[model samples]
Target: MTALRTGVTALAVLLAIVLQAALLPHVGWRGVVPNLCLLVVVAGALTRGAHFGVVLGFCAGLALDLAPPADHLAGRWALALMAVGLVAGLVRRDERPTIPVVLVTAAVASFVGASVFGLLGVVTGDPGVAVTDVLLAVVAGVAGDLIVAPLVLLPLMVLLTRFEPQRRLA
Candidate 1:
């Protein structure tokens, strides 16, 4: 990975994680905070490639796992985000995504990542993680993700594209 690409992505991810952790909790709609860090992975995957996406997802998730107030079992977010990155990378390879595609990808990725985290909690015997809440989370999470996606995506894509000048903007 290019240092420039990695540094840019890292800075963005750090800002996102801080926003998600500090500010977003107060900006939620009925208690669902958007996963801002997910956008970093998505942007990287779409603009860079699958391998970069996977690595970003894993590393970013680990940062989240290590962050304060993260009480869940470690690596859950890593696995989920890695899968999101991989899937987004696959879809991005098929075509340059339109606005609709970006929205749909954000929704699906948010839902799937949250679902996987909830499922991981269940498997790990976390009583607070209700399986039924997974459905609700999917709904609420998508709305939150949709709200932030347009705001986050454009700048992120631009930065990523700068790192990879040959990449055609979608």
Candidate 2:
């Protein structure tokens, strides 16, 4: 069961990265793309826990940073997504997360992830982006993430739920 869940988690991250790399580049609004990988991390955090989310986020973000067409330093995304996972994981509940919870989490994750990445670029002297541009991207990213949260989160929630061992109430 653990192996199956790990495989599914890996597969989900891979799919999200592929989709983000292949498709979203074209469909993005004003150069601000929806972050599917971040959504996946948030889903993991919400379904599992902070530790799992952090690990998944670091892996997924590292993949994104290393993925082709990557312009920025690798560890930038690693740090950003780690923060996203930690924030999202903190919001998890014993009960299944509701739509409102998912939306809120998506919004917060989007903001934190984008801001962290942008800040890192500046701090590291990456010459990657301007503060105003990062602010704009953050706004757009949050909105875009919220719009797609249902599509990604719902299916992922179902999949994660399936992997859980049946709980027996004593």
What does candidate 1's lDDT look like per residue over 1-170, in tens digits?
48877788889988998899899989798778999988888888877777887888889888888788887788998988888788777774666678888778777777777887778888989888786787788788878888899999767888788788564456
Residue 150 in model 2: shift from native, Å?
A: 0.8
Cα displacement (angstroms), candidate 2, residue 89, comes to 0.6
Model 1 ranges with Cα > 4 A deviation: 92-94, 165-170
How close to the true structure is residue 1 of candidate 2, measured as C-alpha lDDT? 100
lDDT of each candidate versus the true structure: 0.82, 0.88
lDDT digits (tens) for residues 1-170 of candidate 2: 99999899889988998988889879889877789999999998888878888998999899889988887888899999999999999994667778888888889999999999999988888775788878988899898888888999878978987897787855
TM-scores of the models, in the order given = 0.92, 0.94
Best by TM-score: 2
Tell me how far candidate 2 lies from the true structure as C-alpha RMSD in angstroms.
Answer: 1.5
54 Cα displacement, candidate 1 (Å): 1.1
> Which residue pairs in model 1 clash with each other?
none
Lowest lDDT 10-residue stretch of candidate 2: 92-101
